[model samples]
Target: MNRSSYPYVKTPPIFRCLIKKQQQATEELTYKPRRRRRRKVNNSDFYWWGFPIGTGGYVIIRFLLTIDWDFGSFIIFMGAVAIALISGYLLIRSYYRDFKSEPPPEYIVNKEIRKKAIDAKNKIRKRYLSRPLKDKVKKLLKGKVRTLEPLTPSATVGVSEKQFLAVLQKYFGQRVNFPNGVFSIIGTTFEYTPDIVYQDSYTGLTIDIEIDEPYAGKSKEPHHCNDNDKDRNRDDFFLKRNWVVVRFAEEQVVKYPVACAYYLSKVIYQLSGIRYEVPAEKLPSIPTWDSEESTSMARLLHRETYLKEHGLWQIRIS
Candidate 1:
């Protein structure tokens, strides 16, 4: 019935930190004395340490004549005094023997032990408590939709998908397919087929190319909403199967289909380490859209306005 029992109340890091602090407190706060060398004592070293610690030679005015306490005389006298003090310090420091280090006490070790305990506790809290919220905040801030769920291969290919497919085929001839690739998570009845599947002959990298329309045509519901977890889960599913998933906006495919293909080939080369020649030499600025934003725009039929404003990749929304 005791709540303080180790199994019921214990967090290992807290217990471990307490034990570590106890160990540190009982630890001997000392050091091995520095070993002195056995070299014969140099009389010159002792002279350097002792004889030059004076400013006697800095007495600038001769006692034989009346001296003027002018600015120039005072300046010279002060300069000589500074130089003599510096020389004395350097001479003594050069040969002075000591066993003690700069901090002079081992009490700093206790401070370090306490600091380490605090840091360890902070790390434990971060691991257990703080990180999930932090991860969620980060997810919200990174508001770009990079990919979406692939279309079902059984259905007819849409006009936008066909255009993207034709361009992808120009560079990756015979390597790309339409409605040919079928994949599913194990122990599940559901099967996902990408709109176009590209298999690299050299590196065997499988690419799942998807053209995501803002909203589902029949359901009138958002298919790739930013708040929706389905597409993210879908991408994760493909990732687990070692397939690289890439999504393009329907407009991006329709407008710059050739650029879309070039971009895809470059992505393929980057992912697979094999380059394929495409007709377009310059990299096009085919900006992607947030899934939720896409869904909203599609629902309102504000595609042109959204494209005009969020046309570049710099604008982001979660």
Candidate 2:
């Protein structure tokens, strides 16, 4: 039986399916343009285009001043320049339109495409919400703690708890307090030692301030994950009792002592309706501490020694 004699040779079902898929893939590859997802235009786009345009203006001005040419030649040159500028402007406008235009309904209605749109919107929202917190964190890290101290009002200040609280007291007097008390969380009692507590003498408003260090307990052990849970519980207890809660990292206290003082002073004045001032003559001598470096290192040692030698370092936070 010759193969040619069999007018219809049956192909296997699996092979037929594979051939169909291959043809479909080939058609998709050939017919579709390999276009990338268009990105949103930003202010940088204007700056990027503006620089060249600005430079070209100067070049044209210089050309006009230096060129020894007839009026006819100048007119022709100007005409060409005008045409080029117009074309460039139109090209940029078209590019912007192409990018900003919405995709076709079929493309937009696709489940994957819709999901991407949702995700992109959520991502932007998250970033916008987190911006302030991130900026504060950056300020803390940059050592521009915005201290209230006149010496370096725009910079970070001290490097120790003693120094931090000293600056606070130096200005606010007896308003600053440290209290160890008991509080309830979820019907359970926990001993809470607030780093600093301020009670407004006039208004009787209370504020609980916590300065967290990397270590825990009198033994100075490293903080475990569960430590945060305990801290949160303590904070909740204060909030339940109608006390205003404020938390600062130890680094923030040390690095931005003056800023911390200013911040606390502002809170106190707002709470008590009483304004306090640091004596101009009593202000401590400020050492040349660079904002670019951490005071916790050798820089801290030097500061401590200097303060000690000058009888300026207070051993007690009070």
lDDT of each: 0.55, 0.48
Name the candidate that leads on lDDT: 1
Off by over 4 Å in 1: 1-156, 281-295, 302-318
Q: Which pairs of residues collide in candidate 2?
A: 147-258, 147-259, 148-258
lDDT of 1 by residue, 1-318 (tens): 122110011111312343354345444333333454333457876566445444434353342133657777677677766766777777645644342434435555765776777667656645544333223323322322223245454555654565567677777887887855356556987767677877644444566777766665545456555466777677776665556667776666656767677777766553334577876744333343466665666677654444345343232211
Among these predictions, the greatest TM-score belongs to 1
For all predicted structures, in order, the TM-scores are 0.50, 0.34
| Model 2 agreement with the true structure over 66-139: per-residue lDDT tens digits | 65887876775686577559656964885567566777666655756657665676666555444443232233
lDDT of 1: 0.55
TM-score of model 2 (CA atoms): 0.34
